[model samples]
Target: MQENERLARTFEEKRPRLHAVAHRMLGSSDEAEDAVQEAWIRLHRSDTDSVENLDGWLTTVVGRVCLDILRARSRREEFFEEHADPSAGPRSQEGADPEQAAMLADSVGLALMVVLDTLDPDERLAFVLHDTFAVPFADIASIIGRSPAATRQLASRARRRVHGASPLPDLRRQHKIVDAFLTAARNGEFERLLTLLAPDAAMRADDTAVRIGAAPLTQGARDVASVFSGGAEAARIALVDGSVGAVWQSKVRPIVVFRFTLEDGRITAIDLVAEPERLRELDVVVLDG
Candidate 1:
């Protein structure tokens, strides 16, 4: 085979993994494919011989593309909001581009996506590469244009953020918080709910939820607490994308999933997902009552 065909074939083989990395970093299949296609173009234009590992080379190129897109995205968040499907929680893998779906099966669920969205662009890139994908800090450093140590620090910071525990809340701690929250919600304990929520707590619900009477966004512990004080009577402790969350179901089908972001025993954010299509894709199971 000619050199160009050889490179093309090699890239084709690595495309699935590349798409996964891009999709995790960019959160959109369209953006992920664009990044992968750009990576292929760069590979074709560059010296393949100088690249020691073809897979690593392609990954870094895609990572760089994703970083650029993320940075640009931060500047144009309004554009994203304008374009985002408020009806959906996170983009689901069902009916996604086949290549992207194959990789998403490995564990790209809404829980992680919600946490990842809270990170800074650089922190997000480092964490996704080093933690989620296990790309070495050296390779990540090159992509983000930071020193390896600096890159490692970024992942460390992101790690803390994602866990929603700077001091680190244990499973027991998280369970206790959620249990308390459920109790407060069931009894319409407004003050009790406020106590369990952070001063700056916020709540976000998808379009389906908003249309059904939930606010699209609510800020302040008092405001968020008020909305939930008389609610959650039917919410049950469940595992949402592998974490302790509340899910309301009709028989066995989940109607709405609530994912919480907790810090220091206080609820910081509540991600209420009611989009049926997206809910169907979530891995949720009710905990034993």
Candidate 2:
């Protein structure tokens, strides 16, 4: 009974930080509270005799709980999109408590929350744990079932998407970077390609692109650079969705569009889009090389 009291005190001390971590990852106070409670329950059930860092252990537990919640939320959203009645009109936001919503918006900027929502479950966890909470990459990697390097890349990609989802302030500079990447890739200049990529750069392909033999996902600067080396001969520098990127055209129409997210003059993320519908949505204008 005495030991239980000590454990309770310790957990209470970590509650605020754990809640903050969950709130940042989930963007919902109620969900964050639930995740924290789940962590407490897990803590009670686990044996801590061998645990060296209880705080880190608890934070990892909370992170894993939040990740599971995010993935489940994604699955539910997908189901709703596929089966919900189109004529039902958008679901009412009435259930949310106005005061809580306002508090959340104030504490975590509404814009930031919206951007965080765009990240994948693992990416969100990695970014929040490593960047926001200062958790180590090794710990985050264990939770996300990835190597430390890959976890770092996930966080980097998420960071780029969160901060790069805006109009380029300098279009010419972006164009130059894209052009350099393409040139290096075409010339098989592996060293130059690596120089153009961020240390944790990543690449992803949509379903249609993967069907055409593009990798679904590639992480790390060396791996990503290798995939592009001796490639992209037919790709032309272009303005894809208002950002400098590249496109592969068949005749006069774009068949594949390469969307890039760059930061600090290094490529952070690359997305290959080949879905016909998605391709149509992009405002791609092939530029003169």
Candidate 3:
């Protein structure tokens, strides 16, 4: 086989696995795809004859690209809040099927990502690659330029932070909890739903123009459930990635998104977002229709 053809076959075999790794590392599927494409460009440009362990090499390149993208996004989210108007930008926040496009919203859980955001880019990369996806510490070290032992330590630190932020709820149970919460919410069983929530619970949506408070924050789950329960008819529910949630659709406008939060088995928070902005950076049409 020709060298390029051989390289292409190897690249194709490894690409999907690498994309999953990158997606978990960076929290955006769109960004993950970009990183993988960039990795292919780098791979083909290099002299393929000398490269060994093409899978590892390609994964490393993709990991680096994801890291760079994370760093750039972090800076934008930090320094450019004033200029961060997604509504006015070229991207249109038009049609979004919340269940389909929100990778972070559906899988990572809001609390995990918020803590992950605090990690330095390399630490976040090392931790997510090793712990979240089970990439070996040695391979992770190769990607991050650290010794395997040091990479292990980095991962440990990040794990502690994630665990401290939110105890790792069994993902399966969490999914079940989401379904129950959504049912309770849509049915307006506010009192029954209160039993499912931790006394102090929180709800936050990123598309909003202002920030809201954290938990211990509410005593009455009934009151909290009112936000979502009463409007159940306008929304549609779907189980995306094992969690039950809803999207508000209307013929005249784009979709509005909501993600439910469950704690101690009760529906405690519902993050309601109707802002036409932030939906665009998310690269999803807000499918209200």
Candidate 4:
């Protein structure tokens, strides 16, 4: 009984931080509360005698629970998008309360939440745990099933997207570069593609895109150009998240989004995102041809 009492007291002390982690991850207070309760239940059932770091264990538990919830939510949204009738109007939010959402958004900074919504689940987890909460990458790696180096890369990518690592180039110039690159790729003009890319250019794809056959990482101008050469015939120029980029649509819904980073009139990086959840969060406005 004494041991149990100590455990209970310890859990209550940790509850606030656990709830904060879940709230940032889920962006829903109710869901965050549920996650915290689940963590408590799990802690009660598990043997902690051998656990050297109870705080780390509880944090990992909450992170995993939130990750599962995000994945399930993504799957459900994809299913609804694939099958729901257009005439039914937009899908309802179900349990979402607008007032509560707004309050949470305000507390978390609405802009940050908007950017967080655009990241893939793993990226979001890495960014929130490591960057927001100062959790070690090694601990996060165990939760996400990735090497510490790979986990750091995820957080870095998310940070760039969230904070705009550098000043954005002029919109008109960016559009022209994107347009020329698309034209070159469609015509198999490999030379033109190379001219528009920096010598050390790189391309990366999210897990969803990689699962569908995209290389996880392509480096060097030649290699990156080769990947796009004779491809992107169906891609169209668009403004993705207020920056000039490209979007590939299937029956009016975006299937793939290409986010570019330009420097000195050359493309330095390209990010191919196809995760349905992330795609839905992007503000894509297809330009009129």
Candidate 5:
């Protein structure tokens, strides 16, 4: 096969993973889609003869695109919001779904897209690529143009800011936590569920979704537990990517996927990917009883 064909095949194989990385980084289905497409465009345009590790190259390109977009977004937000009234627009709500319309007010919740707004572009990219997506430090380094050690340090600092704990909970323990949450939710024991969550937990539902009356992202263990007890009709908790998480069934079908970001044995952030088009990537499978 010619070099271009070989590169094309390689890109095709890694497409899904690249899209996932872009989605998590950009937090917008539209933006992620655009970034990945841009990466592919770059790949096709560049001479592939000298390229080694096509996946790594594509990841780097996509990451850089995301960083540039993030930086531009920051500048625009500062320019428009700085001189505007504090209440010029709708106030951010706590526990609102991370989806575009809900726009939670808390700094840790979907509002965190803004807190992450504070990170330098490289720091943010390393953190998301390594911690969330489980990308290796070497690959992360390639993306950020840093050495592996430097990438490790950058990811570490990002983790600290995001409150990610070291010596992450093993998969079995993660399953146990999910089981505990499932049990508490099923029994309608709000207080017990709260005990399983950290004090400053933040909830995020996909803010860009158009689903009518979708449940809001609930922040804090206590508030989330309350929402679970009051709102959940039936829930199925399962392991996805070695973590304990649950999906809510609305009208006899799985409608929402919930992923918990844990720190020090308590849930720190709850990310709900509510966009129907993006549900498959979230791994919202219905585990049989």
Candidate 6:
């Protein structure tokens, strides 16, 4: 078999697996596709015959490519710079793919991603490989330029951080809390709004949202309630990035989106976003009343 043909066939066979690895590492389907494509490009240019473990070789390349991409965007571990909210609803947010959205959120939980953001590049790589994918420390060591023992240590530390980060609440309870919070907000039930919020709950708006008169941030249950309670009259429940949330529409187009994170059946954080670009990417479907 010709070298090119052999390489093409082998890569095609492994594409799905490689894409899965990339998706977990990068947490964005588009970026995962890019990382996988970059690996194929690297394989295409290299000596295919010399590589004995093709899967391992490709995995290493994808990991490196993803690391580079993460560094460029985040500069340092810190939430991978959410250019677009990872939870921007689902591709079929308003459809029957409720399970699909749930899986997406579970696969790339916003709270979990926020924790992962704090990890240094090498640590994130090691953890995702060893803990998430069960890649041996010996194999991951080469990619991160660390000894196997060091890679193991890296993964351990990252795992510890993850354990201590925000715990996700039951999705069903979370959805109900979101519904009640919005309802209270629309009704101007100030005290009721507080009951549904965490004492330290926060609300933040992206730059685009801020540009349109939204505050950049609000902290504390009282403050957030002050901002949210008696507002959101136009908002309707929808799955924002797989989580049941709210979005405001005009003429059948979304003007802004509300994303929430809950813990213990109380609202913990809320995000207000009006970026048209992000809004376009988010899966938005009005829930049946």
**Leading candidate by lDDT:** 4
Compared with the true structure, all predictions reach lDDT values of: 0.78, 0.81, 0.63, 0.83, 0.65, 0.76
Q: Candidate 4 overall Cα lDDT vs. reference?
A: 0.83
State the local distance difference test value for candidate 2. Answer: 0.81
User: CA shift at 41, candidate 6, in angstroms?
Assistant: 0.4
Error of 5 at 276 (Å): 33
Q: Provide the RMSD of all predictions against the true structure, rounded to 1 decimal.
A: 12.2, 17.4, 8.6, 15.8, 12.5, 10.1
**C-alpha displacement of 104 in model 5, angstroms?**
12
Candidate 1 residue-wise lDDT, 134-219, digit = tens: 89999999999999999999999998888863332244456568879989988999999999999999999999878878899999
Q: Residues 91-161, candidate 5: write the lDDT tens digits.
A: 11111123321211121123345446457778888888887777789887876678999999998898787
Give the per-residue lDDT of model 6 (tens digit) for 1-289. Answer: 6878978999999999888887777666667889999999999989867778999899899988988887775653234334535544322223233343343456666455546767877889999988877888898998888899999999999999989766654555555677788889989999999999999999999998899889998999999999977788877777665467888766546778888988777889999878876776776655523
In model 1, pairs of residues that clash are none
User: What lDDT does model 5 reach?
Assistant: 0.65
lDDT of 2 by residue, 234-270 (tens): 9877656546678887664677889999899999999
Local error of candidate 2 at 12, Å? Answer: 0.6
lDDT of 3: 0.63
Give the C-alpha miss distance for residue 63 in model 3, angstroms: 0.8
* Candidate 4 ranges with C-alpha deviation above 4 Å: 94-99, 165-289
- lDDT tens string, model 4, 212-286? 899999999999999999999988776677677888776547777899999999999999988877776777755
* Comparison by lDDT, 2 against 4, better one: 4
Q: In candidate 2, list every pair of residues with a backbone clash.
A: none
TM-score of each: 0.51, 0.57, 0.56, 0.56, 0.47, 0.57
Clashes of each: 0, 0, 14, 0, 13, 7
Q: After superposition, how far is residue 263 of candidate 5 from its true place, in Å?
A: 23
